[model samples]
Target: MKLYHYPLSGHAHRARLFMSLLGIPHELVEVDLKSGAHKTPEFLALNSFGQVPVLDDNGTMISDSNAILVYLATKLGRTDWLPTDAKGAAGVQRWLSVAAGDVAFGPAAARLVTVFGAKFNPEDVIGRAHVLLKRLEAHLADRDWVVGTGPTIADVALYSYLSSAPEGNVDLSAYPRVNALLRRIEALPGFVPFAKTAVGLAAAA
Candidate 1:
């Protein structure tokens, strides 16, 4: 398998994290998003969206980080990572949705704004982030992981960007439960730190 990815992308990190955790041996093909490599004809053939983190599992090409997680988990027959039971599957799916929806819009996009200077309306995203963080804090009050007793794809999907909320000027200090959840995910074996990159602005030297 070959993964086309950018190191700084949380979505790309999701695939990398899962592969590392499962000890899946594959090649990493870095896509230069700044140089528009992902928009080239070669990459467009793999994914029309022109996104990073496209996985080529032999002949089967999969895009979207969450979808890739499902594909890999199913292929490996590691249902524990994704759960097979109806209710359990739904719970996993719910968190994946949260990752894509609220998490992406809030922490991820906000980080893009703060880090890369992306045109983000702070009044718009920051308030939404606070609301989402509060809800997550309350939800995680009694659970270690998002869905089940152990870590699942849901946790992998949300952990990257959500854990880096401080970079976006989103104060996670208000959410102790959510912070604990982040620590738990980080304490997992084979965990990798999210790589920082020049997104919207250059980091202070």
Candidate 2:
């Protein structure tokens, strides 16, 4: 398996992190976003949206981070990471929606502004991040994992941006339960970390 990704992209990081957690042997192909590599015809052939985190498993190509997570879990028969039953599948899909929707517009967008000089309003995105964080804190009150008694694709989908929210100026200090969940994910065997950047340094970038 090969993962094409940009290091600073949270979407890409989630896919990379999950492969690592699964103990899957893979190659990392770093896409140079700064150089317009993703915009080229060759790269866009893999993903029409020209996004990072495209998985090339043998000849099969999968795009979108959450979709990659689903594909890997299902194909590998890691039912522990992705249950096949309707109720359990729906439970995980709910949070994967949050990862694509709320998490994207919230912490991920906020981080883009700081780290990549994107034009989103810092105040607005940061506020949105907090709103999502508060809900996650509540949802995680008595649970270490998001959708089940053990870690699943839902947990993997939410990990990258939530753990890196501080770089977007979204404070984690008030969300102990959320922070605890992050800690538990980090402690798992084969855990891989998202790259970290200082807020000041990211802003200057």
Candidate 3:
């Protein structure tokens, strides 16, 4: 298996974290997003959309971080990270939606703008991110993880971007509950720190 990703990307970090937790061995192929490497003809053949964190498992290609999480969890028989029961599954899915939607658009985009100069309206997204953080704070008030009583793909999917929210100047001082959740995820065994480039982007092109 080959994971084409940028080391600093939170989306890519989610996949790396899961692979480490599952003890799955695969080659890490870095894609350079700055130099337009992801847009090149050679890379476009692998993923027409030309995004980082594209996973090549044998001949099967999977894009999107959450989809990769589901694929790996299923393949490694680590369903505990993604429960089989309908309610449990839905709970995980719900958080996944939050990760892709609110989390991505708000804190994640805010960070990209601050650190990478991505064209985003930080003032608008910062307020939205605060609202999302409040929701997470309330949800995590009495729970250790997002979905199940234990950590799940939901937590992994959300942790990377949420942990780095401060990079975007989004203060986390008010969300103690969310802070606790971040600490718990950081303390997980076999956890690999999300590696970011000095420029705050992923390692691969």
Candidate 4:
């Protein structure tokens, strides 16, 4: 397996992190987004959207971070990481939607402004981030993982951006339960970290 990714992209980190947690052996092919590598003809052929984190498993191309996660779990038959039953599957799917929707527009968008100089209203995205965080804090108040008893792809989907939300100036100090959930994910075996930028370091300090 080969993962085409960029270090700073939370979306890319989702695929990379899951592969690590599952102990899958793969190659990391860094796409130089700064130099327009992702938009190149060769790259666009893999994904018309021209995004990082495209997975090539023996020439089978899979794009989108969440899709990659689903493909991996289904292909590997890892029902532990992704439930097979209807209710369990739906539960995980719900959070995956949140990761793509609310989490994307909220915490993930906020970080884009600081980390990549993306043009977005900081106040708006930061507010959205907190809104999502508060909901997550309440949801996690009585549970460690997002979907089920054990950690699933849902947890992995939300981990990258939420853990780095401070970079977006979305302070997480008030959300103890969410912080605890982050800590729990960090302690898991074979866990790989999302690389922090200068903005994130200052926010942490």
Candidate 5:
């Protein structure tokens, strides 16, 4: 297996983290996004979208971080990572949607504006981050894991950007439950953390 990724990309980290948690050994091929390597003709053949974190499992390529998590979990037959029952699977799917939707638009986008110099309204994305964090804090109040009894891909899906939310100036201190959840995930075996960028709030400090 080969993972084409960028170190600073949370999307790429999610895929890499899961494989590590499951003890799946693979090769890491860093894509030089700064130099427009992702847009090259060779890269386009792997993913037309020209994004990082494309997984190549023996020539079968999978794009999208969430989709890659699903593929790897299901392929490995790891029910704990992704439930098999309808209700359990649906529960995981809900957060996966949140990861792609609210989490993407909120915390992830906020980080993009600061860390990546993306042209998005800082106030807008910060507001979105707070809103999403409030909801997640409430949801995680009574549950240690996102779904079922053990950690799932949903947790992996949301962990990267949310853990690095401080870089976006979306404070995590207000959400203690969210913080506890992050700490728990960090303590999990084989957990590989996303690389941190000391910008945004860190710079202000």
Candidate 6:
């Protein structure tokens, strides 16, 4: 298996991290986002959006972090990572949606403004992050994992951005439950970390 990704991309990190957690053997191909390598024809062919974390297993290819996660979990026959029951599956999907929506527009967007110099309003994006964080903090209060007693893809989906939210100027200190969730994920065997980028509001402050 091969994973084409940028080290600093949370989307890519989620895919890579899950693969590691599953103990799947894969190679990491770092896409040179700074050099615009992802915009090339070869790269776009793999992902029309030209995003990082495109996975190639044999001749099969998949794009999008959450999509890749589902593929690997299903392929590995690990229902624990992705439950098969209708309600359980729905639970995992809910957080995947949150990862793409709330997490994306919140902490991820805030980081984009500082790290990538994107044009998002810092106050708006950061505020969005806090809103989502408070909700997650409450939701995770009595739960060790996102959807069940054990770890699942839902936990993996929310791990990266929430752990790195501070880098986007969204503090995690107020969210003890969320922080505990992060600590539990980190303690999981075979866990891999998302690479840290030094550019963000936390650095400036």
lDDT winner: 4
List runs of model 1 lying over 4 Å from the truth: 197-205
Off-target runs (Cα >4 Å) in candidate 4 are 200-204
Error of 2 at 138 (Å): 0.7
lDDT of all predictions, in order shown? Answer: 0.87, 0.92, 0.87, 0.94, 0.93, 0.90
lDDT of 5 by residue, 31-117 (tens): 999999999999999999999899999989999999999999899898989999999999999999999999999999999998889
lDDT of 1 at 197: 51
TM-score of each: 0.94, 0.96, 0.93, 0.98, 0.98, 0.96
Summarize candidate 4's per-residue lDDT along 1-205 as a digit string, tens digits. Answer: 9999999999999999999999999999999999999999999999999998999999999999999999999999999889999999999999999999999999999999998899999999999999999999999887889987999999999999999999888898999999999999999999999999769534557
Cα deviation at 113, candidate 3, in Å, is 0.5
Residue 3, model 5, lDDT: 98
Q: What are the runs in model 6 whose C-alpha is more than 4 Å off?
A: 201-205
| Local error of candidate 2 at residue 178 (angstroms) | 0.5
Better of 3 and 6 by lDDT: 6
Q: What's model 1's overall lDDT?
A: 0.87
Candidate 1, residues 1-205, lDDT tens digits: the string is: 9999998789999999998888899899999988999999999999999997999999899999999999999999998898999999999999999999999898888888876678989767877788899999889888888998998999999988887777777778789888888888888888887886543322331
Candidate 2: RMSD to truth: 2.0
RMSD of each: 2.3, 2.0, 3.7, 1.0, 0.9, 1.3
